[model samples]
Target: METEELQAALESAGLSQYQSDAYVAVLELGKASAVEIADACSVPQARIYDVLRDLETDGYIETYEQDSLHARANDPGDVLANIRGQAATLAAAAEEIEERWERPPVDDHMVSIVNRFETVLDRARTLVAEAENEVQIALSPAEFEELRPALAAAHDNDAVVKVSIHAADESDLPDDDALSGTVTQMRHRTLPSPFLALVDRTQACFAPQAHSVNQYGVLVDDYSLTYVFHWFFLTSLWEVWDVIVSERSEDPPILYTNIRQCVRDIEPLLADGATIEVSVRGYETGTGVRQNVSGTITEATYAGVSTASGEHIPLAQLAGQVSLHLADGDEDWTIGGWGAFVEDVEATRITVESIQYE
Candidate 1:
């Protein structure tokens, strides 16, 4: 490159403005005093000494003490090499930070675990072993069998392992002997809903099928979506399965309880102008109803009313609904025929009588 171009490139590489000017001044003068260098480079005379010292330290210029001061340019090759080396070091540090930030959030997760059954098993084992209070598994019998060892390990660690199986028969579970005396403590149930597993109300995994030979699933760590999953699992699926396991059959109470809890847990999370999904098994002629309603809230003088295009009203209209069913607790409560509404100082809470999702 030309001399000016080379100097500009060096400056761009990381040279301070004063340093670049001083170095270029030394190159032009061959040798010069601090005052002469500063005058030649248009740098402040008072800062000339420090700038020279910095350039010399950086190996861009050589300085000598005389009557005043004398300096000369270092080899341009060495100066450029030093600048490039500094640039490379900065780039490497930036790349290292980027790599760290891009890494998966899971602790101790290995990239090699992808599509590797054995690695997945190891990951599952590690996750299960880390469970503290509760471990829930929704899996087919075959899938459950594959993770039986890890489940047993969780049980050994004093974790409550609640297993929801999709087996055609409960007898498909390993005989009581396989549980090593912990079978009695294990909460086993059959779920009609599709696959879902939760651990300590934090981590969850779900497959697409209720009963499937393949155990392909995605494991999610503590996240916003996990909160929604926990609500759905505990209120709807788990409650219904609990009833099924307890009563050994799907009863009307189980359906009602699950539906009530589902509505209770899901409503608050809905955005003000968003549609809420209600999944129910029995609605039209006792067949079932699964529907989505776009709801909007309108604040009024005395109260607010939420409206939707469908028969079900929006959550905002909850306060004025004549026949809503309100849950009993330490709060302002009202029940109407269609659903329930609870009014607090901040907002009105509404619960659906029955909900089903399409």
Candidate 2:
């Protein structure tokens, strides 16, 4: 496989563009010199060595030292086996991670009951560092001061920051005048607990009511419960829910946790004749195997779905088996779930990136 075919095949096996080029070049030339390989691959000769080094590291190429270094493609069969082994290793790790964290694949989660104050602060800082998009926190002014570095890093990472000080005035901060400006928005309010932090509106850590002031905190990344935390603090207790400070020009995809709810949500727009893009990831109940798919939603009903490949399965069959990512732009409504509900699913999620949703 040379040119497009070779490139596609190498890419499918997880080779970088340059690595694919170099590997194919080496294989094609058969025992070629570095310059010859570079020339064949159309890669800069000076840069070829680095690419070759990476390829060798990945077991895609074998290098020999002589008057000048020479290289050859690793045996195709051996490389294939290596790919299989690497893939299996990755899958096993993913399974272990999934076993520990089955909700939305969030990286760092602190769901522990620690009596020590240091443990609480450490976990809160960890959550801040792991935040990828937005950080919505409800804490005292003092607590905010303590987590300043973590919050600053989150802000610098371009995450939208929302801070609600529970019973503390923003103006009365003993320090952090400069850091205060970095907060996208600040509000003052009262809360039931001493400390509460929510990141990306998807995960939260709240100090449960206890005899001690900040006795222990419970962290949760589960979608089922985070909404309550947001509503309780951002809406009920604190009162200001305006995240008017826009993080992105476009809103993030609305994540629907349940299959039936998603079906109901999309029911009204049936007349729009929208070609939906749906991505699904879930477990095949029968095989106990996980699957993932993201593509156009061709057929759907209250019970199950047909997506990406025009195949449909019943809901009870995949009960609690799927998660959906949906966006209805001007022309189409895109939905995505893991393999449990869709077909031809891949590890790398595909989306309706072509359309812009307002």
Candidate 3:
């Protein structure tokens, strides 16, 4: 590259014109006095001293006063590295300021436009995967047609897809050809809402009424706001028209069983010293009863229960007081007619032996 181009590049990288010229001159002359540098670089003698001071401060050049002003350019590698480092620092500081100002509010609703039909489909697939329990979708025939592939993808991943459409037929939608069987588990429903879909009780998106027969539409992903929309649709819209709906299971029994197992695993981790307030519903009474108690290794106390019968009792004393019986197979095992137990010293499972009403 020419000297002028190199000078321009250096200046663009944040070196002053004089500093760039002086450094180029130094590179050519090997080493030079301030007056010689100024003459070679076409910089004014008065400004040469200021330019040298800046170069020295930036570690781009070394200066020595040996009876006269003496200056030499540092390594070219070192100069470029320092300039790059300074630029990065400025960029990082700007990013932090931008992030603070651009932070999103928790309650704010956000709308984004997806011009491509495929992008909208991908987003819907992502929403289905993130859904915890339920999913609901309302789409026009054209948009629903585009979502067939996305629906199959969701089904392949074991997601329960519940779709509502305005005019699409159930037989027309895509079927799972890989298994040589149709996607029979999809829930199909009919909705009058002029939009595409709602998923996970959180996100909702709408197809443009203009492109309800062809192109893509505006997609909204805010959950809290969509709940309000759902409420309005259920109350105001559902009262007027006859809505057709269908539902199918993904893995109903496995889902419920997994939830029960999770509760069982977490129960033991609720240690002896832990206090929990539980509202339990009885099978026979069919009413939820609230109970709060603190349990320990040696004793359990029900301070929240004001009745005299609800007083605390030691682990060993619980056998007689609660009509406890030990299981024959396990020595440390016991059963109690009431809900109270010892920790590690003895484990007890409670059953509904009887309920006495005062």
Candidate 4:
């Protein structure tokens, strides 16, 4: 008996369902007529001749004429070799399709338009399912439902998923317990009309339908393009307002997306006149000058040596870089600057460590 996985692979390798069935059936029978092959594979006798013809043309089988038509499976080794060659060619063609069809320039952001809503939905699901590290998405309820099954599969595979729902209230979140086994971090805040999904911070999908009745989308593969879309969504996420679930049970690590959030985390310390000993370890974004500062925070916003005007300082002055440090046994943790914070977040270079607090 062929394993289910092997059968799936056979179908995926470009064999039609009936073709695969006929090939396997003939192999099991050693030699059989079209009628016999059909019976063995449960295919209609009318379809067997065409199935056998395709299999023969594809080098999966041989046909002989006797008193009745007879068919036999090809040598397993030869069949496998042909399949391998076909697979290699198919893979090359797939790559060539992207190259020729996309023709994306390396210098600028490239966007591929997806016309069909179904195609957009499939691509979005694939982005989530194939994520290695994280999937950050701002989803319409429709988009969310469309991708939930794949998201569940990704969850089962240990990929992290964070979803921001375009719902007015937490109660408006998807109540169906389809994802009973998976832990899906859902935050309910009204998002924009267009649905957006960012995967591994590398791939982005913008499926929107506002001005027109037809749903359309853009698939982004370029890093700058991906970041721009993500930043836009994140910026818009907090636009107008954000609703946080109070008394929530889980406390996920704070992933600072912007300067404000980073500053907000340390505001209490600065307000209470507590001098927080912070260590920053990143270079200035503009000059690339290595900045290493270890000292008290005069203001929560600026991660700098001088007590300069944190809000008023120009972006070029600080170069946008900082490292956050916590003392051993110190519950307080602050390690990001606004301009620097945004830069670090974009580059995934934020470093947090412990420093000796006198």
Q: What tens digits encode model 4's per-residue C-alpha lDDT throughout 44-88? A: 988888889988998889998878778998788876876788889
User: What's the lDDT of the predicted structure labeled candidate 3?
Assistant: 0.50
Top-TM-score structure, candidate number: 4
- In candidate 4, list every pair of residues with a backbone clash: 280-323, 285-319, 320-340, 324-335
Best lDDT goes to which candidate?
Answer: 4
Model 2, 1-358: lDDT tens digits are: 3387968767777888888888878877888888889888768988988998898888878898868878988778878886688778888999988555422233444344545555556667888877766677776666877888888888887666777665434355434464554566666564435567777556777775435654655667765476567656644444343332222323225343234435444443332455555555444434546554455554444334443332334334344334333333433332323223252221222222222223
Local distance difference test, each candidate? 0.53, 0.59, 0.50, 0.61
* Off by more than 4 A, model 2: 1-110, 168-170, 173-176, 190-193, 208-214, 237-331, 334-358
- Per-model TM-score versus the true fold: 0.34, 0.38, 0.42, 0.47
Better of 2 and 4 by TM-score: 4
Candidate numbers, best TM-score first, in rank order: 4, 3, 2, 1
> Where does candidate 4 stray beyond 4 Å?
1-109, 153-160, 168-172, 176-185, 189-192, 210-214, 238-260, 271-358
* Better structure of 2 and 3 per TM-score: 3
Instruction: Give the higher-lDDT candidate: 1 or 2.
Output: 2
